[model samples]
Target: MFKNSPYTIYGITALILIILLIILFSYLGLNLYIISYLISINLVTFLYYGFDKLIAGFESVRIPELVLHSLALAGGSPAGLLAQKLFRHKTIKTSFQMTYWAIVILQIILILWLSF
Candidate 1:
């Protein structure tokens, strides 16, 4: 299913890293609320990608880019990246990718800042 895209490898690697982080945090007795929020948002973001892909096939009204970015900023980026690669949705648009990566970078900064 990965086909010829290197992005598919990167996406899966990111997902694995996220899952490992989650497990480590849980083992360290970190905040359950945060963990739950991450899981929820990721699931929602993944589903949104799938939904958007399905609609796109039919030329239906699409989900707003802002909403997708918002979800990524809210801790769903791993899922977003995975979905983008796996579903091949929203991966070809330069504008969307730029915004999405911006969100991811911002989130990483915020996360590092918060950890300190």
Candidate 2:
């Protein structure tokens, strides 16, 4: 049933590309602090998504999608995807998915462009 799943491919590809880029750049002036920053930002993004999912059924205010998208754009898309997969959140909204995938693709493009 998972065959032909674009999500699977996208996730796998993104992970591979990220790792490769990190390794590549680490020798070309990338510092541990930058990696730490990515890790920290990703952790925050992951927590935010989880928090939003937890409060989804409440009558209280919700975490805005814009914030989520912004987090993803700021080097947290991987964590965002992980949160979506783990918590089963934001997977059903086609518009949100579109925006998310677009952000991911943009990140990939930016990385490739900056690599050269």
Candidate 3:
């Protein structure tokens, strides 16, 4: 029903991520502060993506790629991926995608190292 609006995908992805996070945290007994931080960072990253998309439509000054990568590295890569897909932004840029995936991989490695 939301064929005309990209927001449907964004909302769905956010909801699913939230649910999954809750479940995973419950299973792992992770700290509340980390959960809160992830939620806040992801929200900010999603807004950044939305803002960047808006500016792109108008040919206005855009948010820097470094800033975007920083946010993703700061625990927002899942949100970044969702935003990229939902907004159809930055997905076509191979360099950006490569860097983004690298950030994701690094984060995964960090998480694994810390979990042990």
Highest TM-score against the true fold, candidate: 2
* Per-residue C-alpha lDDT of model 1 across residues 1-116, encoded as one tens digit per residue: 65644345434444565566667667777769577558856887888788878888686656767667877887889999999999999999999999999998898888899999
Write one digit per residue (lDDT tens) for candidate 2, span 26-113. Answer: 7667669688558756877788789889989998566678778877998899999999999999999999999999999999999999
Deviation from truth (RMSD, Å), model 2? 13.2
For every model shown, the clashing-pair count is 0, 0, 0
Order candidates by TM-score, high to low. Answer: 2, 3, 1
Say which prediction, candidate 1 or candidate 3, comes out ahead on lDDT. Answer: 3
Off by over 4 Å in 1: 1-31
Tens digits of lDDT, candidate 3, 7-26 = 55444544565567656666
Rank the models by lDDT, top first.
2, 3, 1
lDDT of each structure?
0.78, 0.80, 0.79
Comparing candidate 2 with candidate 3, which one achieves the higher lDDT?
2
lDDT for 44 (candidate 1)? 71
- Candidate 3 error regions (>4 Å): 1-31
Count steric clashes of candidate 2. Answer: 0
